[model samples]
Target: MLKDFKPTLFILARFILIYLILLAIYQYFLNYYSGTGLDPYSKMITEQVRYIQNYLGYQTQLYNDIKNEQVYFYVRNDYPTRMVEGCNAISVMILFIAFVFAFYKGLKIFTFIIISLILLYILNLLRITGLNIIMTDYKEYGKIAHDFIFPSIIYGGVVILWLIWIKHFVLKDKVSNELKDKI
Candidate 1:
């Protein structure tokens, strides 16, 4: 009875460890940057998205909103949409890191993670840019695009990256051996 629970417990422990560490890092950034004169990372994300939008000849306007004397970032491409903290992709990246770390600890995990995160950040930028473009170009589909498709691109890419990590880096021999022992 206890033996069967071991594998589940191992998985849970790995997941929790990864999650807490990543969450701590995320929370640190959130708190450290919250009450400052500026949030450098959030501004970077907003600027990157705006640069891409501008490169594609979509004029964008960026401004800050202050509530309780704390600054919030926002961008507009015709219609205004606030880029409020969550839109910056840090949370999604944190979740991605946690998920990737949970599954396998094969050699080069950090290498793969760093490269994957860079790619994911680019994809997230594209997702942000695409959503704004959709708002401008495909007005009729704007709701569904915002609510469904663009997010799917970022999250779906995470799933694909997870699969790639498992298939390419993690050894089949080790996995099968673990499976054999667990079973």
Candidate 2:
């Protein structure tokens, strides 16, 4: 039993090692950017959200409040949402890219990574805009929407993409298909 599982375990180990290294490198860059005064990732997310709001004909404004030292923006009046590091979706992009790197390191991996990152960023901006709209109109559902519903959509999308990669790249490969036959 253990002999048969060795390859799977080894693959798992490699996944962990590579994923952590990639995630660390990503975090380092994110931190480096944030350390320079304004966090570009979060700032972009805020701006993108603002753009979406404005596109929809909402009155939007971006500003910094010095007393409390928070950088945020307003939408649909003075309704504000602060742009923080977590809202940037860097963490999700890191995880998405890590899974791709771990599963298959083919020539097309770079293309897949770029496409996945773009899709995730777009999804996140749409999520934020939808949440802002929700919070603006139906305050009672805001907490549930932000805390549970929206995260499920983003993370669930990642899970689906991972499964697609596995189906198309991993299981379709000759060696992995042989392993699947044995298992």
Top-TM-score structure, candidate number:
2
Instruction: Residues 150-173, candidate 2: write the lDDT tens digits.
Output: 899899878988887887877778
What does candidate 1's lDDT look like per residue over 85-147, in tens digits? 766677778877777677666667789889999998899888878877877777788789888
Off by over 4 Å in 2: 34-38, 65-70, 175-183
Residue pairs in candidate 2 whose N, alpha carbon or C atoms collide under 3 angstroms: none
**How accurate locally, in lDDT, is each candidate?**
0.74, 0.76
Assess the local accuracy of residue 54 in candidate 1 as a C-alpha lDDT between 0 and 100: 81
Clashes of each: 0, 0
State how far residue 137 of model 2 sits from its true place (Å). Answer: 1.4
Judged by whole-model lDDT over C-alpha atoms, candidate 2 comes out at 0.76
**What's the lDDT for residue 142 in model 1?**
79
Candidate 1 collision pairs: none
Instruction: Find the candidate with the highest lDDT and give its number.
Output: 2
